[model samples]
Target: CLTGAPGDAARNAAFLVDHSDCPAVSLAGDLSLAGLAWMFSRAAGVVSVNTGTMHLAALAGAPTVGLHGPTNPLRWGPWGRNVQSLLPHSGACAYLNLGFEYPDPPVTCLENLPVSDVLDALERMGLRERAFAGD
Candidate 1:
C-alpha cells in the first residue's frame, strides 16, 4: 500500500499506481495514527518518500525503504529496525547543507535518481524478489 497526502499529490500517486503493473493501493490521509500503526505493523514492507509513515513503518519492524532527495538521511531517515534509506549522490545537490531546512533552490535530485538504482537498493534490502514475484 502507498499512502500520501490528499488532493493532487495523492491523486497523482494513485494514477501512477493504477498504471503500474505492481498491485498497490494509494491511500490518502484518512487513516488515524492508531489505524496506520496497525496497518504498518502488518505490512511485509513499506516504500515511501521520506514521510512519517516510513518512520512509523520502520518502528513497526516492517522493512521500510525511505527514498530521500536533497534532504540528509542521517537527520530525517527512518529509525529503528528493518529500515533502509535510498539517498541520491551528494554531488547532485551539493549546495544543500546537512540538516538544512527546505532548500531555497528547488532540487530535482530524487527525480534524477534512476529506477534501476532504487531497485538495486531494494535488492540490497532483500525486497526485489518479493516485489516482483508475480512478474
Candidate 2:
C-alpha cells in the first residue's frame, strides 16, 4: 500500500502499480493515521520513502526498508528493529534535508539510488524470502 494526497505523484504511482505485474495496491488519503497503524501492524514488511509511514511501519514492528534521499539516514531513518536504510552513494543533494539552511529541498537525492538497489536491500534483509515463504 502507499500514501499520499490526490496529486501528480499519487496518480503516477497508481499508474505504475496498475501497469506492473507486482501484487500491490495503492492507498492514498482514504486512511487515517490510526488506520495506517493498524495496517502496518498487519504488514509483513513495508517499503517507503522518507515519509511518516516508514517510521510508523517500523514502530509497528514490520520489517521496513526506508529510502533516504535529502535527509541523512543517521539522523532521520526509521527507528525500530528489523529496519534497513538505502541512500544515494554520493551526491551534492544526498544530505540536503529541508530546513532553513535548505528552505526548498531539491527533488530527492535518494532517487539516485535505483529501484534495483531497493530490491537488493530487501533481498539482503531477507524480506523477499519471508514474503515468498508467506511468513
Candidate 3:
C-alpha cells in the first residue's frame, strides 16, 4: 500500500493484520533507496504507481503491476514484459501528459477501475492462481 508519511500506515496495517487471516507486511513512511532495494529483493511481485519505487522494482527484475490514472501508461509505465499497467478510460483526466502529482489525483481514476477489472488483469498476468494443489 502506498501511504504518505503521517504514520497512520502502521495503525492501518495493524488493523488489517488483526482483522484478516492472511499475513500482512507493512513498511511505513517514506522509504529510502536501500529500503526499496530490500523490499524488491524479497518480494514475489510489485504493485505500485508510476513512481520511482516502481522503476526500482522493474530494474530489480521483479514483475510490476502499475496503477495509472492521469498519466499515460505508454509513456510512463515500466518497460518490461513482466510489467502490467492499468489505466482509466480515455479523458479521465486532462493532465495525462504530465507526471504524477496532486493536481491529477490517481485516486479518482483508480476508484473507477472495478475490483474485477483489477483481478482480471492480475489473472492475465498470471499473478492470480489457486493457492495449492488442493484447497
| Candidates' C-alpha lDDT | 0.74, 0.76, 0.66
For candidate 3, write residues 36-134 as lDDT tens digits: 777776666777777877778877777777878666778788876588888765446425565545462344566665566666666777766632224
- Which portions of model 1 miss their true places by more than 4 Å? 8-20, 94-103
Model 2, runs deviating above 4 Å = 6-20, 103-108, 130-135
**lDDT winner, 1 or 2:** 2
Winner by lDDT: 2
Tens digits of lDDT, candidate 2, 1-135: 556555635784768767896565667767778988988988878998868888999999888999887767787888897899888766644454453345354454664788888878788878787666654
Worst 10 residues of 3 by lDDT: 126-135
C-alpha lDDT (0 to 100) for residue 99 of candidate 1:
55
lDDT of 1 by residue, 1-135 (tens): 656556646675768767896566666676778888888898878887776777888988888888888656777788976787777654464334455556556557876666787788678889889888867
TM-score-better candidate, 1 vs 3: 1
**lDDT score of residue 83 within candidate 3:** 81
Q: Model 1, 68: alpha-carbon shift in Å? A: 0.9
List candidate 3 stretches off by more than 4 Å. Answer: 1-8, 14-19, 29-31, 89-91, 100-107, 130-135
